[model samples]
Target: MLLPLPAQAAALDGSQLSLLWGVPFAGILLSIAIWPLIAPMVWHHHFGKIAAAWALAFVLPFTVVYGLSATAHGLVHALVAEYIPFILLLTALFTVSGGIYIRGNLHGSPLLNTGILAAGAMLASFMGTTGASMLLIRPLIRANDNRKHNVHVIVFFIFIVSNIGGSLTPLGDPPLFLGFLKGVTFFWTAGHIIWDTLFLVGTLLVIFYLLDRFLYAKEGVQRQDDPTPDTVKFGFNGGRNFVLLAAIIALVLMSGLWRSGISFDIYGTELTLQALVRDIGLIAVIIASLVITPYSVHEDNQFGWEPMKEVAKLFAGIFLTIIPVIAMLQAGTNGPFGAVVRAVTNADGSPNPAMYFWATGLLSSFLDNAPTYLVFFNTAGGDAVHLMGPMASTLAAISAGAVFMGANTYIGNAPNLMVKAIAEDRGVKMPSFFGYMAWSAGILLPLFVVVTLLFFR
Candidate 1:
């Protein structure tokens, strides 16, 4: 069930791509990492233009070398094959989840926060990292808003809800979704990484529980002005969007299960019928949720399009600029990045599942994990059948690495940044870029090492 490569008239030679082609991608990454700290006003106001500049930096040179037609094919390939579907799915999840507000005035406690985190982790594999994050983050934040020392709640929220929770299914993480589209079965990830996921989630929950308990003890009592009533009764508003959420899930599943062999040739890229249906259906769901759901629901959720816009603009630059980098990795020993390829392989030429895990995870911690996953997947021989057969462990390693280590940094996945921005806007003073990394370095890295030894070994 491997999708056919686009029949491009003039395929760019990855071997011919110089390492300098990576500069634009690096530029965007640095901008994302550094600009927000050094010049917050400039980044907030002009980040889109900056992202577009980096994209054009890559696209312009590519057009000059590859001709307008081939350049059109590449753009079309990135959009049709990757970006459009990606943003649409995100939009659907963001919109649908935004409409359904968890209306309550409940105070957050160690037990309650951990319980909420555990529930969100379960919902992630089914609703998506983005969907589940959007649905739960505000509630979690609101629950702990009155607490004096509540930053760690948001941090662990990112750790579990935004990253590790999504390891179980394609719906959970973008990388897994890319794998599914590239012909990995839907349940393939759940089957391969079930134990690893459970172990990591269990251990993290235990650690989070201890940390929250210690912090809870320091807060002498709830603030005098805390609005959360002692006997608050919880209810869900915008219940209509729940059906729409189910529709989104159903459409995604349909795209995978019901391949009618129908497809369209869009500038040499083949867009299958089911894929088209899925995207169109998702778009419809987004529109319906926006139109049907009352504006009050969004207001209650404090929903704004700024975070979504940031993600879309930034990722547009990322998907476009990453072309050369992915091409180089796929080129293996024949390309400028041959050392990267060699490092992930055994001397016998067999795949090293452990190296694949760490290499993919570390890079994914910085790069967009979807394309990062694609690079290593192609490196491990892009045949889905073989990858699921003899190379199951390697695929599992890649899957686990890409999804889990996304918590290692803010931009590792889109939701991490979104959750941070949302939290900060709600008055949580989030850590600076390197400061956040300091948190992950001490917390997640050791846990990941243990996960590596226990499962990847």
Candidate 2:
């Protein structure tokens, strides 16, 4: 077992940190947004290095100013408390889901495509956004490979399956899971936000169906030669991985529900026994997937580690660079982002649900939504009981914002980027980082406004 650091070596005080400390985080985001568009080859080859450079840019300067011990503590806390668990769960999901290959192709009629999206939306809550996206994206792409105008299909898939669909259950998204770990009841989100989810999902589905119908009509009956003809009967391969997927879900649920009251302190970070068991269990699941999955399944699915690698490397830097940014936000009114914290409150000091919705959402668009949800959850007084009771609307707003608006940008959620990477790898010609934002701004922003008026207000 690891020994704890002295109590004096606690986390960095965001109240004392200057705004300049956020430069590296902004730099990384800009690099992600611009570099790929301007210089695709360089960005692809050296993106990890670029991410690492930005991370070092923050760490090196921070170490000099705050002393090595403080910087070390911060880094340890960020990794031990946040990043490692995050990547492990993602890895397990990616491996297990990637192993399951849906054989044969179904033509992507507008109605059929809409039905698949609807099914994926339902699956996302149970299997996780990452798992559901990986499981369904390949089949969706295969189904639509012949379509002339299919980009909208993929974009809407990201919006519906990978983000908004995950809103109803903690098992669906990271932010909600974090909320669960913080003592929110298991079904609280479903009970509170079911209507909001139904409205957004139902509306998006109708819009997708209509748009796809229009595009399908414009492209004529046969848009392009079907790259994947429906020659074989439709079926699933790697069926055992489904069992592993269930095990993954069980591990996650067990971690949240089982209280061992045992933990270790690595530097200043607390590592709980249930979390340790969950991580170890996930590792076992990943190994089991790779070992038991048939080689033919992997081949037919065209499954590769590149998408997972891209997500892991990029997020390593994001989680690292975001350290001081989270701290500053956590500092509340005293921090540089005091305006953001203040926007969620009224003059009489009651939480403003609409402002909470927008504030949590806009920031979650660029920043990591999980921690952003935590910041706002605490900002609304951190008592889950009170938030779930008198402040139920506020909690609901924060939850909805973090989970739903994650589709606004590619990097807003881990699965979004992974889906983009996989789609592009399969020759989908997906939109660029900013290009995706244009789609979201046009479609989702208007819907979000309606959501704010109808629900948050």
lDDT of 1 by residue, 164-205 (tens): 999988788989987887788888899999888888888888
| Model 1 CA RMSD to the hidden true structure, in angstroms | 2.8
Can you tell me which runs of candidate 2 are displaced by over 4 Å?
A: 1-8, 178-186, 214-227, 366-390, 421-438
- The per-model lDDT (C-alpha) reads 0.86, 0.86
Cand. 2 Cα-lDDT: 0.86
Candidate 1 matches the true fold with a TM-score of 0.92
Q: How close is candidate 2 to the true structure, as a TM-score?
A: 0.89
Residue 292 CA displacement from its true place in model 2, Å: 0.6
Off by over 4 Å in 1: 1-8, 218-225, 230-232
Candidate 2 residue-wise lDDT, 228-343, digit = tens: 76679999999999899889878987887788988898877788999899989989999999999999898877778876787678778877887888788768788887887778
